[model samples]
Target: MLSRRAALRFGAVAIGATAAAAGAAGCSSADDDRAAEPDPLLTALDAARRDADAAAAAAAVTPDRAGALAVIAAERTAHADALATEIARAAGEDPTLPSATTSAAATSAAPITPPTIDALRSMLAESQRGAAALARSLDGYRAGLTGSISAAVGAQQAVLLR
Candidate 1:
């Protein structure tokens, strides 16, 4: 019973409504999902921080290796700072603030048991492997940063740890 003009108008309205609904439903879901996933760099950051803490603690426990441990601690701390900055930059957050990807509370909640010199060396080896693997999986500045860290950790493990 509808006229040709009415049919055309109805078709247009239906198409528009369907498009609007689709847009409303999934317009930002992809972005939200990406934001919800923890950044891989978080693992690297955590490893760096833990290594730094471990090295410092081990230095306190064993004075013989204090000088080498101090260097490792300083370098690992620098690596952590760089990784945190990168994470903040990627997330479009303020670099000074703790990244939303990793809450400050979560970081503090993890207990750090001081490791022996041998354990610290093992930890560095693990960190080097992880950083190298992550570097391979990523690209651009992130890959370079992680690769550089990996090389530094490798040097620490091979040269300083001996």
Candidate 2:
């Protein structure tokens, strides 16, 4: 009795649920009972950090705006360092810097014009949103973690948004 689109949507949802269940099961499989990898998340965070850094650098070229952007850059650097530490703890090794492809993807995207204070503020707002999302994604990895690392990281991210 369903329309064609409704049937298709239902089928897609069912397939997606099945796939998610399978993936969850696979994580518990005996053959490869290792923890889930955090490299992908780290890589994403690195790229985001790089983009934010680049934007901060560009903003710093103007003397009047340089001080504010320098603060933003320092905060972003701290965030990247925190993410790297978490990635290292999760992976049982130091986090490697992202590859050329990732660096390019992060920094070489299309340019935006921030010709005024309001425009620059808007750009920084967008960057903060992205950073917040990345932080949230990384927070999911702290389920069984000890101590207050996750909380600290979340606090730092909140400071960045401010």
Residue 97, candidate 2: Cα error in Å is 11
lDDT of 1 by residue, 1-162 (tens): 999999999999999999999997795797688789988999999899889989988888778899999999999989988998999988879998876544772557454677988899999999999999999999999999999999999999888889
Candidate 2: list runs displaced more than 4 Å: 1-40, 94-123, 134-162
Candidate 2 residue lDDT tens string, 1-162: 999999999999999999999998886683354454335445445544654555475565667656655665575566555556565655556446554434554576555443344544454455555455555654455422211333433343355333
Maximum-TM-score candidate: 1
Error of 2 at 39 (Å): 3.8
Q: Count the backbone clashes (under 3 Å) in each candidate.
A: 0, 0
Number of clashing pairs, model 2? 0
